[model samples]
Target: MLDAHAWVCCDARMIQATATIRCAACILFLNGCAAPATSHDESRTASSASSPDNLSAATAIAHTRPLFDVMTFSQWQVVGGDARFELHALANPQESAAELTLVGRGPIPRNGFLVSPRELGDFTLTVDVRIGSAENPRAEAMNSGIQIRSRRMNVGQGNAAQWTIGGLQIEIDPSSRAWSGGVYEECGRAWLASLAENEAASAAFVLGGWNRYEIECIGPRIRTKVNGVAAAQWFDATVAGVLAFQVHGGASCEVAFKTPMLIEHGIHEWRALADEVSGSSGERCAWQSTIASTTRGVRLEIEGAARVDLLADDGARLASLSTSPEPKISAENKAKPSIVELLWMEGEGAALLDGVRVAQFACVTVPSRVRVLGESCAVLRAESLQRK
Candidate 1:
């Protein structure tokens, strides 16, 4: 049995393409990158923090004091069509991101996925996905998505494509303008609720790049956020099932998934942008993108009105229209400026403003602090925070 009180807000980060954590009613529900907690784990974390040599423990806790790390063919199975999986090269030359690419060389419109072994209920899930770049504007419909509370069963469709998964699907539509964060019921009624009108979130997903996806499942209410912007939320009764990352067959397109995290019974928006425009200055603003992950997804997008480029700590252009922001999708997903993070990624919040260098904001989870550039890097007053 699992204790209800032992919820550990953890970093459910994908250490490698294969390294994933699972929780049996144990976890932190932030950023969807959380794991289960156990008795005495807190004391172990405190002691391990002082000893850096315990990389294994530190690594586990670093992501989110998870009880079990699930990897390998034993913990995962490939479903839906004959697709291949391998740890391949990353698009960004500078990042050593652990990503599993699903190369679909089989039939078109093939829906393949790596399904987890365990079935979970009432949890938050998040993942970063990068679809194959389209050669032109009229690109083939290379689609991908994350499955929630789903189950695998052999459909009547014989051969390698016989296995079918059914449940709720968090759609990742690179081709459609407003279909990224929308939720659809698989093998059942379709299109539960759409984010078609949410222009900000619909525009949040950039084509041919990494995009962050957050899914919160609590009771009958399921909310989804894309790139820290609240996309959609609705109610349903089908509670518990396995999780899967899908590589929907498309126009000879390959898909990659990284930073897949799960927390039992919670939510985190650790990477959400806090303050974009300064209160008094109002001269600058910020933009959050998977490309901002280099600096943990916090980049300064100077206000167009300012018309002045911002420099980094080394005096290089940091925030400019022509800078062509680097491809950064924080191993931990980040929220946008307008996000009302229920409990940001592991209960921490991040913000990027018009600052120079690869530095902008620093956040501490315990006694959560938000820091911004002012004279020197100082702690922003926590007047609104309450101590229990």
Candidate 2:
């Protein structure tokens, strides 16, 4: 029978959920409410979620992969320093929406974020944002942003203790100046790039209205847009982490987010996040990584988002590129099996593999050389790039 597990699965918009519904017609539970779902309701949900071409700005979001989850305050956890915030539903009368308001309380405060428990690698995230002014109405007042491929980290000690988020933040500054769509590293490196750096893009943000902010992160290269205009971009080699919404500190401020949606590729981490939810079946799909054997004893590391596994051939494991301590490779420790095949999951535009992207094939086997995607998101292969 459809139990509580089915209830949570239905929340993600994927409810072929493995649990048999005892009474699909008699009773339908959605977000803790009992309502009867009709044939038309079922058909519309199935079509919109599965059709790639059906996606549009109007109505509900349509995506290729089943939606991982909506960024509702229900599944998010407040992190960083001692920030105090309140999350509540924003009644739209006809549509589902929510808001996150921070009272801006805390000592030794730097910034606060509402981070999802799920770690994402490659995805497109969009949200409607309204930047609010702080108590004093200074530089920190007109600040709010969406943090993608980010992490929650704590630094300092004692009263100096600070809980801060480190990673890339899409800068949202709606003041006398226009730097809303710029890209800034929260606590790591300073600024990478911004619309303020570009003349024409700086005018993309429209004042005094709901602005749609989108972040397209494929591997290390990230492109941001404000109201559908290109704003800022930067490239790095690491591309995997949790997504978060920011409330900049320094003054008592309020920020609101509504209708957050995400489109993901190679979603191999949903089950882990589901396990944390109550009564979730935690459905999992298996994907194997193939070892591309070029030469003996040479190490090859494929770093993506979330958990990292050592790529191995025979019994010997390839050393990791990071200074992070070596991982113990055992049958029990690693989940997926390493095979003899090599394929890049999605295209460079949507996702990346081995830091190189080959656009010709949906998923190509280990090629001798491939082009690196450019700033324009075009795939370029260097043929000379041999895995050292």
Candidate 3:
């Protein structure tokens, strides 16, 4: 008795559950498939297998390299305000992890950042953060953030010389509002995504204590999680920039980053479709394909006058663009090959003709196919971004 929409939802949930069970079984099978261990290996394995925490420690020991070396801040630099950075050993004698602490001196004149020297494109970063310590108890009220796809620029000159760092920021707010994990545009368009309506995400931050943050960026899509709870999912045009840790330009703040890890997923590559189709004399040629919601864009090369339409799953037009000067293509007119691109993210879409935008539209739908209609037009090449 379930409706079409309800049935789809139920089917999706069932598939997810099945996939999770299969993944767990695969892990167990792989573990059992390992070669027989030596006496020393057996002893080590027995000790770690005794508890999940011990197993996690063993795994950590296997991969001890961090994204940056805290022992010497060679990969990082401080920009703007007078903030002090130091490496401190963890208080726990049993643990070998160290923390990089940033302490601001009194009130800062402008926002200061502990920024990465190199720029990153698509990547996954995880960090354990603590807002305040016994020595800086007032740091709980301070504002801070982790910046991705950001840049530093000199805004003034001479004695008035000042640097400004701006880009996408994963907020580390410690105020009563508790918007930790929200996405904000630092020195840009302001709040890009907020956790105000998401009670669980907003309440995930523990005041004056350590919390884990995981951020993933692939193409234009960005997602964040706070202590295992999904926080934000958004998209932006900025694809590459430096990563940074911010100390807002106001009150003194003390923030510690521990065991910062990173996994670089290089930029998404464009893959060409296998089939090519041509449309001529008012004939329409269509290519059926599913465009993932996370796809950054689609590219196609058209030779001669043509109109391309991005169609939704229901065959409805989501966005369209045409190279023809008139509504209908003239069979006598011939044109050279031109590259056309349809870029989309969620509700917004833009069409570019040879690297220049010619049309833009807003629609809340997933593109599923591409259709070309024209006279004497041929789609030479079609490409789509590979999913992460």
Which candidate wins on lDDT?
A: 3
TM-scores for the candidates = 0.47, 0.50, 0.58
Tens-digit lDDT track for model 3 on 12-83?
132111111111111011111112232323422332233121111111122334565422243355566656
Candidate numbers, best TM-score first, in rank order:
3, 2, 1
lDDT of 1 by residue, 213-239 (tens): 888875445789988999876544344
lDDT of each: 0.46, 0.45, 0.64
Model 1 segments more than 4 A misplaced: 1-68, 71-74, 88-109, 134-140, 157-161, 266-388
Local distance difference test, candidate 2: 0.45
> Sorted by lDDT, highest first, which candidate order results?
3, 1, 2
RMSD after CA superposition, every candidate: 19.4, 17.0, 18.5
Off by over 4 Å in 2: 1-72, 92-108, 133-140, 158-161, 267-367, 370-388
Candidate 3: Cα lDDT at 234: 65
Best TM-score goes to which candidate? 3
Error of 3 at 247 (Å): 1.0
Tell me how many residue pairs clash in candidate 1.
Answer: 32
CA lDDT of 135 in candidate 1? 40
